[model samples]
Target: MNRTDRLLAIVLELQGKKTIRAEELAARFETSVRTIYRDMQALSEANVPIIGAPGQGYSLMEGYFLPPLSFTASEAVTLLAGAEFVQKKLEPNYGVHAESSKAKIEAVLPEQVRLEAEQVRATMRFFSAREAEGSRRERENMELLRQAMLDKRKIRFHYAKTTGPVLQRESTRVVAPYGLAHIQGAWMLVAACDLRRDIRHFRLSRMSGLEETSDSYELPPDFNLEAYRPRDDRELKVILLADPDIADRVRESDIYYIDAFEEHPDGLQIKLRVRRMEDILYWVLSWGADVTVLEPESLRSRVVKEAQKLLERY
Candidate 1:
């Protein structure tokens, strides 16, 4: 951006990495070494504890760590604490780096701050600590799928659906593999399920024997996962207000996450990207009065009719 912004970015770069050469920083920011040297001086004058051999660039002083954006006391507690929490969520092989980095963080925190962090550490609860499925296979299928998706090569896989038996499938549709996401502590794969005639999301653990075919295809120019997704609001636009306390209940439900409620002043308003009125009605009815359905007269009618049925049974 501007010269002032560039100088600060240089300091942040050094703080983030163990060490960086002046020439490397200069090249990255498109500035001369002389300019970088001047920026280093400006940093030092501002009490930014940057120190290293001139040729080696710089390193944050082990004794002096800078909190991101000069954090206030509680803010500092939140940051280091958040990092510690993430240490548990990550798969271990990658978490070694996180662990070593956490060690440095704890080393630099004042004793009181570190103690406060520990108090938090003792109280957090994880529902399921079992090692997740596809803890290993996911990494393998991902790489193969990534190549096939990008080069637009066809893929063959033995995939098992949520409700039925395993099946073999292949198609000429372009495959676009997006990143892996963790949901309910399980890994899910978001990719175009070629035979499904649209973008599809699959649990990685459900896919087996993924094989890339030798043909390459072009992705139709207008394909988007968001647009292709199924909605659960019928043909009507159904918005909903969910109870704040009922959030966990919603998450625990078997409803697919085509779109979901986000908390707002109107409460947690969930949008159903795909229609499933029978399903959504059952979902709302399960919550009782804790959730209020809004919009779409059709959905309201279904809920009302279901409530009548339930009352009759009672």
Candidate 2:
């Protein structure tokens, strides 16, 4: 971390504890003991009430507390910008929390810094890939699932899975909640499904009647999320030619796993190792004429058949 951030962290750490060993602080910050000593001296010189005990450690003088922190104008702007994005794009309740937290921060900031932050907020914006959003019920479900993950507890919920063109089925599931992620502007829960006997990703929006289970689960010792994901058993190598505008959108979205991308005079050529052909076909169709499946005649034929079905429906 930079010097300013490190100094702030040290102060916060000191505020939380009665005493801290110099060695402990050094190890935590990945710095040398000598550097920590220098930092303590610097804090002492700055009129901070740091009392030291020989061979013991250091502590703030009894009843001594620092005043509320003041942020630089640029720092205030950066913080406000991040909070604005979270408020605009994240879970509904989380967005509300962000707004409340931003208000608290602004209340403590200097007038000039607050004014600058407000100006920055007024000018900056963020956009989501999809227009549809999770309802308040979905956000509540996310909080329950998050609590389950934190407590190492199992969760029971009814999951609705799409089985056919116009049908879905709801079934009760008891799962060991592992993690939650925001992918492609939606929330998904990753868990070890007892019914499936494997790790699976379930869309939070599709879950209903969630309940925390009494059972506890032990986390697998060798489980790694990054390693567990990008799992494709039936990998199909395919290619696509995309307009520049659509290629940019693809890069920003989790619509496809791009293995390689090449720029050309006509457009961009994208190579991918995909799992589900139907998902890929629908994603390409969403781009309309901006994207073309250039290889794998089977995929092309499937898209054509789907298009024909659409024509018949119309």
Candidate 3:
């Protein structure tokens, strides 16, 4: 970048961090220490409040602030896109905040850039939240869970398990929440269940009568989420042959189960490793006649049996 842009970026960087060494800035900007020193001198000459000390680092003087900067057309569009995502994917409260934030940003941006960003936002859409069907109570629960996680406090809620098409008996649960994850279009809370003395994943939709408790607990430092995640020990390699017409679409998806794909004269040969045979079976069935199970006799037989049952019903 040019020297003028580098000088401005250095000021922004200092504003972000408490202190930055000349060496660190040099590496970050891909320049020599001498160039950094010169840049720092230039900033100070321009009346930018920068303090420097030996054996320490460079820092912005206390109470020093930069003037509001203009956003480029690209930057404005990027920010608007992120706001649009938060509005569509997150809960109602967050969606409100996202809209408010977008308005504030637009108010400060150049009119031309803001107008361009609006056009970009109009072109995108999200149907995930609609499919998930979040209610007001669920949205409130999500916010409460987030607050509890941040405060390191306990939460109490009545949870019900889905038994077939109906819910079974409801049970009161008190737990210390660790994190929240969106999996397969559902919101799940990962927490340490006090009753079970183990970590469990609770669907937020299944929880009701939520309340935050005064009890606090420290999370174990050694607890790595990767280690705590559920893993399938048994690896089953399965293969499929798909018609060339929809092969590219399947390949573009990059499903987690798929390992590789090879082109055949009539179709695409796909290889996958899955923990459960049913997983691959359902996925292959989704393609209908476009895909055929090529290996693992058990999977092929299961598919044939299911297809025959469907035919019999028809």
lDDT of 1 at 39: 84
| Candidate 3 C-alpha lDDT tens digits along 1-314 | 99988998999999988999999999999999999999999999999999998878999998898864888877888887888877765678899999998888899987888878778777876664444334445566898998888899999999987533445578899999988877756678888999989888888888988999999988889777656775445489998998999989999867768889999998999999986786556667778989998889998998899899889999
Q: Which pairs of residues collide in candidate 2?
A: none
Residue ranges of candidate 3 with Cα displaced over 4 Å: 126-141, 155-175, 181-215, 222-234, 252-254
lDDT for each candidate structure: 0.66, 0.80, 0.84
lDDT of 1 by residue, 183-256 (tens): 66666666665666655666666666887788666666775544554333345456777887876676566456
C-alpha RMSD of each candidate structure in angstroms: 9.7, 4.8, 4.1
User: How high a TM-score does candidate 2 get?
Assistant: 0.73
Check candidate 3 and list the clashing pairs.
Answer: none
Ranking by lDDT: 3, 2, 1
TM-score of 1: 0.45
Roughly what TM-score does model 3 have, to 2 decimal places? 0.78
User: For this target, which candidate reaches the highest lDDT against the unseen true structure?
Assistant: 3
Which of the numbered candidates is closest to the native, going by highest TM-score?
3
The TM-score ranking, best first, is: 3, 2, 1
Q: How many residue pairs in model 3 have overlapping backbones?
A: 0
